[model samples]
Target: MSKNVDYMVAIPARYASTRLAGKPLADVGGAPMIVRVCQKALESSASEVVACVDHELVAQALEPLSRQDSRLTVCMTSQNPRSGTERIAEMLRIRNIDPQTIVVNVQGDEPLITRDHIDEVAALLASSGAQMSTLCNPISSIDDVFDPNCVKVVMDKDNFALYFSRTPIPYERDNFAQGQQAVTELKFKHYHHIGIYGYRAATILDYLQKEPAAIEVAESLEQLRLLHYGMKIAVATTERPPETGVDTAADLERVNRIFASQGK
Candidate 1:
């Protein structure tokens, strides 16, 4: 972690998940998943860690933890924000955070998220001078290349994102045209976009004001909206892949098992 960099981590802990209701309050080991995620943020070098929650139950779950750590707090936000980005934007506004302050948007479900990745993204945004910053990892499996669930990103020479999609990008025309199922060699690398983000408070507010872009709507990716409005998003590759985030019952079970094995 860069010692000079200072930032806040805002986690959007929406209670109403379609796949798993009250996901933020779901248990991982002996603790609520959002609580675990918040603990991770609190452990980081961030000057402050706030969990932006929509429900009273979610805020209540965090209260005990917040009471133990002064740096950790909870913000009650409206359920109207459609995405985590919007939720964080509202958090910034309600807190009256400085517009130029760097904020990292860490997902509430990512209990096992590493502090290194969190700090890396924030440091990148600070050093690169981009409006936003994110991380990605190389796609090792051919299945991930074709899997729509695995969002792909293509970057320029300087690592600025050119596009993000649910489909394979920088398309391998020859390989696909030849009906090759296996990747014998690579012409270009395929990268899976990591969901973590770092942005200035002002940039997030500016993003909320802009109309959604057609490509963003088509791809179901909010980051494209920033690109459409001519904002630069710095992209960096992390050597260590992030841990699994809880989205479904099976994911919750898996994470629980991992926590149990660790004697957490």
Candidate 2:
């Protein structure tokens, strides 16, 4: 990957989450979760890092960090963006960022997200010249393959995504018939899709304008919309899996324990 490729890290932080209310403001270590997420983004090779938030309190929470780092900024976005990608699209327009600029969408709740993975996705998009890029990790457990919460992705030989679904793809029919344990003894590797994404500002805008695909609506996966429009999404495998993101109270507790152990 070229060292000179300029990219921006944009995080979408919405205050109201059904599972974990005020998720962005949740305390992790000594700082708010959103602030911790911003710190991670700042550690990346991106030229700029902006947290796109829905609530004023979320922006206020990021004030100290944004003031300390020139590269960090906060943008208050619409409260009702259908998804994080849409919020980022709104932010791009609000900030008047150059359409050609590359932007990486990092979830605000993932405080443990590493700079290496962030940079990897951005570098893949920059070097591959694909419409978008993302990372995935090999599924080591059989439970994750059947778990609807864990989205699965199948890639072509070129490492471009062929399909993404909640249910397993390229189903090992013979192995599955032997039951769950047999499925684990796979002939090919199954992959869990990481949510992070890299795309040009213009690509995001164009994506928003396209009609949502039926498969996207059915599976509740936004990336499918891009595929419906014939966009290429390059995928890379990551050896190091990211720490869990805070989604529920239990997840928050788990992440906090991890932070405490790290002496954060």
Q: Please, what is the TM-score per model?
A: 0.96, 0.97
Which candidate comes out best when scored by TM-score?
2
Global lDDT scores for all candidate models: 0.91, 0.91
1-264: candidate 1 lDDT, tens digit per residue: 455899999999888999999899898888899999999888888999999999999998989999999999899999899889889988988999999999999999999998888989999999998999999999877778888889999999999999999988878988766544656765779999999999999999989999999999999999999899889999999878787698999999999888888899
Off by over 4 Å in 1: 179-185
Tens digits of lDDT, candidate 2, 174-235: 87887776664666689999999999999999999899999999999999999998999999
lDDT of model 1 at residue 113?
A: 93
Q: Give candidate 1's TM-score.
A: 0.96
Candidate 2 lDDT (Cα, 0 to 1)? 0.91
Candidate 1, residue 134: lDDT:
98
